[model samples]
Structure formats: C-alpha cells, structure tokens
Target: MNGYHILLVEDDSMIGDLLQKMLVREGYQVTWEKDGENVLDIIHQIDLVIMDIMLPGEDGYQVTKKIKNAGLNIPIIFLSARNDIDSKLQGLTIGEDYMIKPFDPRELLLRMKKMLENQYGTFTQIKHVFIDAEHKKVFHRSLHQEVAFTAIERKIFFYLYENRDRTLTKEHFFDYLWQLEDRNPNIVNVHIKKIREKIHDHTGEIIQNIYGEGYRLNTHMKK
Candidate 1:
C-alpha cells in the first residue's frame, strides 16, 4: 500500500499542481500530465487516472472512449467545471466518475480513495511460503527458512507466481529470463526443471506443464 501510483491529467496547471501536492501529502506517487495526448503512454504504469473533462487536443470523453476501446480497465474520475446533468451523463456513459470543479481538494482526494477502494479494495498479503524476491529468503508463515535459488530459478518462480492461472509461453519466459538478448529455449526448460524440484521438495505440488503452452501453478492439485 505504499506509494500507489496515480496519474492525473488536468489541463489547468494550478489545479494539477494542487492535486499533485495533496496526493503526495497523502503518501501517493503522483504523475501529473497536462495534455491528453500522452496519456495512453503512461496509462499502464498508473493504478488509476484523475482526468479532467475538458482537456487540450481531445476532450475527456474522447480520451476515455479511446482508453476503453484500447481495453484498459484502469479506474478514472472526471473532474470538470461543467456541472450540468448532460456533462455528468456523458462522463458516466464513458465509465468515469464525474466531480464538479471548485470542489475541495480534500474531498477530491477522498473520492479518489473511494474509487480505488471499490476497484482494488484492501489487498491482504498472502500468508504462505514464498521466496523473497530481494533477499532470496524463503518465508513460511512469518518464519524465515533458508533456501538457495539460482538467478534464473528465481526469475521463473516470480514470473509464474505473478501470472498464476495463465499459461506462459516459452518466448515469454525467454524474454524475462534473458531480456531482449537471444538465448536458447533449453535454458528456460532447465530453469523450469530446477524450480519444480525446489518447489516439490518444499511443498510437494508440481508446477504443471501445459504440453505446448507452458507452466501453471495448479491450484486444483493440493500440496
């Protein structure tokens, strides 16, 4: 919950600055963008967007439409000077929460908090054994257990856990394990084998291979 990234797209410099200050004071990582054009570029990095209805180049409605068309599910809140029903309806039609201008900064912050809460709620840390990404320490119900993991083994484990139910391709593994640099697919297979052995020794559950696709943590198969 530390430093949740927020993208604020406001044409007014003063309002955007104030919003950034308020969010930063509340311990949020704020990325303020004044134009609507560059919004899509940074959309992936932010958890949510605080958008103004009237923006330069493209209006908020058009921006929101494009975002939805692109299949991005990030929550958006519309802050605009237009307080008419039509404006509110338009914003809501495009899947945005509309708030009038001259609103209190604290209240705006609260609205943003509410939207985020409704979307992601409060995430509870999973209480299970996991190899710590940074320290490489194995954690089992708050107890630190010693476990050795090679660089590639750690990468593969983290990738699989990050994408739990989804089947990852060998290309995806190669990209993450070896970056954009070329590497043999056998390297991915070797790392997968090693990871399976370690996880099996500890938990006795196999990371299932999907024949042609890749691997998955088979939650249906109990440890």
Candidate 2:
C-alpha cells in the first residue's frame, strides 16, 4: 500500500503541485509530468496514472491509446475540468475512471484506494512481513529489507499468498509444478521450508501446516 508508484500527468502547476503533495503524503511515490512525453519510458514502473485531458502536446486520450497499444494494463484515471457528457463518456471509454476538476481530494484518495485494491489487491501482512503478490515482492517491515525468494520459492509463496487462509492441497502444488521435471510432492515441503525460513516463520505460525489438510497461509498471524 505504501510503495505504489503513480504517474500524475497534469500541466496546471497549481493542480499538479497540490496533487503531488497529497499523493506523496498519502504514501504514494508520484511522478509529475507536464505533458504526455516520456510516459512509455517509465510506464512499466507506474502502478496507476492520473491523466489530465488538456495538455501542452498529445491529449490524455491520445496518450492513453499509446499506453494501451504498448500492451501494458496499467490503470488510468482522467482528471480534467471538461465535465461534459461527451468528455465523460470518452474518458470512461478509454480510461478506468474519470474525475472532474475542482474535486474533493478526500474523495479522490478514496477512489484511488478502491481502484488500486480492485486492480492489484490489498496488501497482506503477516507479522512484520508485508506481501505484495501482484508485484512479486515481499518486505520485512521490522528489518526494512526485502525478503528474497528463489524462483520456485517465489512461485510457491505466491500461490500460498494468493490463496491465503484457504487450504491448498499437496496435489494443487503438484499440479502447479507439473511442468517441472521433478514433480515430487516433497518439493512442496522443501520450498515451503525455505519460504518459512526466509520469512522467519520458524514455528509455522504464518504458514500453518494443517494435520489433515494441506497448507494454509494464516492471515491471523498478521497481528
């Protein structure tokens, strides 16, 4: 939730400064661009985009087409003063959400939070560890370090994180690892052991081992 990078494309200095300050204070890393230039250069790193219709060069709609054509699925929100029906329809057609100028900052924050949750899912925290499943990254808040995982370890952890609180059978993991040459059921145990060690869940508190069931990433350990 804290590390979401946002691209704010607005030419108005007043609005851009206000939004940049607000977004940063709300725990977002923001990049303010006066126009549609250099979007593709950093599009992959951007989690969401706040676009303004009126700009110095290519309009918001045109920039949106470039983004879409680049094959990236980054969500865009149009924040423009043009609140007419035609503009709204056009904005909503290409962008995910459209908001008019002179809008409430609080409402914008709420809408942004909702949109981000819907797009990338809310973060899952287990003890001092925070899981960003969509971005495939985990951070240890206590130590202020990213928890590294091997490719297989990351896959297994992601699977468990995606289905947190649900019991995923060994067969589920086996089916997941079907493509691997070594489809041994014990591989799940090995990877889970490594994952638990990396996350410092030595007592199986975060990743629980059900006696009859398979395994479940217990969200109750978040406390």
The local distance difference test score of each candidate is: 0.72, 0.86
Q: How far does residue 189 in candidate 2 sit from its true spot (Å)?
A: 16
Q: Give stretches of model 1 more than 4 Å off.
A: 124-223
lDDT of 2 by residue, 46-131 (tens): 88999999998899999999999999988899999997999999999999999998899999999899998898777766776778
- Clashes in predicted model 1: 0
Question: What number of backbone clashes does candidate 2 have, counting pairs of residues 3 or more apart or in separate chains?
Answer: 0
Q: Candidate 1: worst 10 consecutive residues by lDDT?
A: 138-147
Name the best candidate (by TM-score).
2
Looking at model 1, the pairs that clash are: none
Q: For residues 1-223, what per-residue lDDT tens digits would candidate 1 score against the true structure?
A: 2325788989898999988888888867788988789888877777788889778888888888888899988888889999889988988878658888889887877878788767655432222344444444443322223346776677677787667667888888877767777778677777777766655434424467788888775444331
User: TM-score per candidate, in order?
Assistant: 0.56, 0.65
Error of 1 at 137 (Å): 16
